[model samples]
Target: MGCTFRPHFGYCRRISTKVNVLITVSDDIYDVYGTLDELELFTNAVERWDINAMDGLPNYMKICFLALHNSVNEMAFDILKEQELHIIRYFKKRWADLCRAYLLEAKWYYSGGDVPKSIQCYMNETGASEEDAREFIRCLISATWKKMIGEQSMTSPFSKTFIEIEFNLGRMAQCIYQYGDGHGVRNHETKDHLLSLFVQLIPP
Candidate 1:
């Protein structure tokens, strides 16, 4: 996340962090707290992407939905003002997709059936060992990174800074989840990584 100090860069980082925090809050609501009916209402509100949709949501969900709506709208407003691009539709689609995925997972949980994770699915499909599945997953990740790098090298309408920011987001996710779901669960490894990057000093 290192960059030459610029107001634009600082604003981008702040908005990114805010979105990530909102995502974590949404995930917790889906996975830990909200009942199926409440989750449905919340997901529908998000899918609608309208303040008016908040009417049916419970109190907690109403607060979360309003926060998400306001933050996303504010970001969209900034982008529209600066870039002259109407990207709210793109943002809304992504959020809707995320909520749909979360809702599916919640449905799975309430059904009382164990769902195999990606690693397990790979192992089951290929009759591979756990280690082999992990290696396969690593290979897939590497290939995806290669593709992203290739895309970065190609021509695009986006500015170089914007492309780099998008690429860095992928890198950030890799670092955070390198060990596990670091964002979802606090672990010593993630704590140490953050500390070293943001808090600690290097000796010359």
Candidate 2:
């Protein structure tokens, strides 16, 4: 797995970090800050994947969109130079899809209607307590992991490295959110986890 990333690991890591940061910022904007109309404009701009679309966005949004556009296009440019393959359309579509999903979430939130999430739906249908609903979610996660592991053992169209990366990403998300909204909330556990992962070195 480590060998698969040789020579370009630092570059890949940097791009991944930038992309994740952008995603977090975009999520925050759609979830807590941006107005419905503003979100619509932002989503449209992402879908269009045009720098000119930045003109109508607010100052903060303009900054965010430009960063996203530049970072993504830079990645696409790197790939094109290395592989002679144009992938900007795929990257743009992914960003557009993510923004559209966020826009839908914002719409649901601003609508002020009861949008039952999986846990809520389970609780509502089963008359389960919150704790039970949480346990149910845990079970579901465990089951999903089992399925993922099973699938990994079978022949897959994805390369082994790609599958490994995908699995690691899932694990990373689980670890991050295990303590509770680790990405959004500042807590001691998350701090400790980050320190262990990135700061502390193990004895050889």
Candidate 3:
């Protein structure tokens, strides 16, 4: 997805795209498809990092988990072979954190309590007042962008191409969350951008 510029880090860009796809799929499963119990099981399986742990998952969840696991492992393999870096720990930690965050949202959604839709589920989970939640969203987005910008200015082990990909991702994430998941809803502007970005032919 970050290959729009025809950069030399095509492999890393592809890996980044795969990681994004996995996260999107898993988010959909947890938010739209899975029951609370099934999500718990799947999250546990990921946390445990055991193939056997996947045995109890539903067929759909098992499929999603396998795709995520295999893709992550393939990326790790690439990093290891090319960079002499064993970054699997970083990948695993990120995935586990993703699962935990998603699980919290799912729990809040299914708690069967009368929670106002105006307040985000995470706010409900955190016992934040609606006003506080609203303020927090602003602060969170600002803080996240600040951090990414700061990271971009710093020296890091990651390649410049990889950092650019991360910055693009953060920007996209901010856009997606700023207006109620426009990408998922395929809002007019989002649909137009998606079509242009993903479907239009490039001039040779």
Q: Residue 44 deviation, candidate 1, in Å?
A: 1.6
> Tens digits of per-residue lDDT for model 1 on 45-124?
89988889889888989999989999999999999999999999999999999999999999999999665688999998
**Candidate 2 per-residue C-alpha lDDT over 71-189 given as tens digits, one digit per residue, 9 for 90 to 100:** 99999999999999999999999999999988888888888955467788999999999999999999999999999999988999998877877887888888888878787888899
Models 1 onward score TM values of 0.88, 0.86, 0.73
User: Which segments of candidate 3 are over 4 A away from where they belong?
Assistant: 1-4, 113-159, 174-179, 196-204
Instruction: Give me candidate 2's TM-score against the actual structure.
Output: 0.86
Best candidate, TM-score: 1
RMSD of each: 2.3, 2.8, 4.5
- In model 1, which regions exceed 4 Å deviation? 1-7
- Comparing candidate 1 with candidate 3, which one achieves the higher lDDT? 1
The weakest ten consecutive residues by lDDT in model 3 span: 113-122
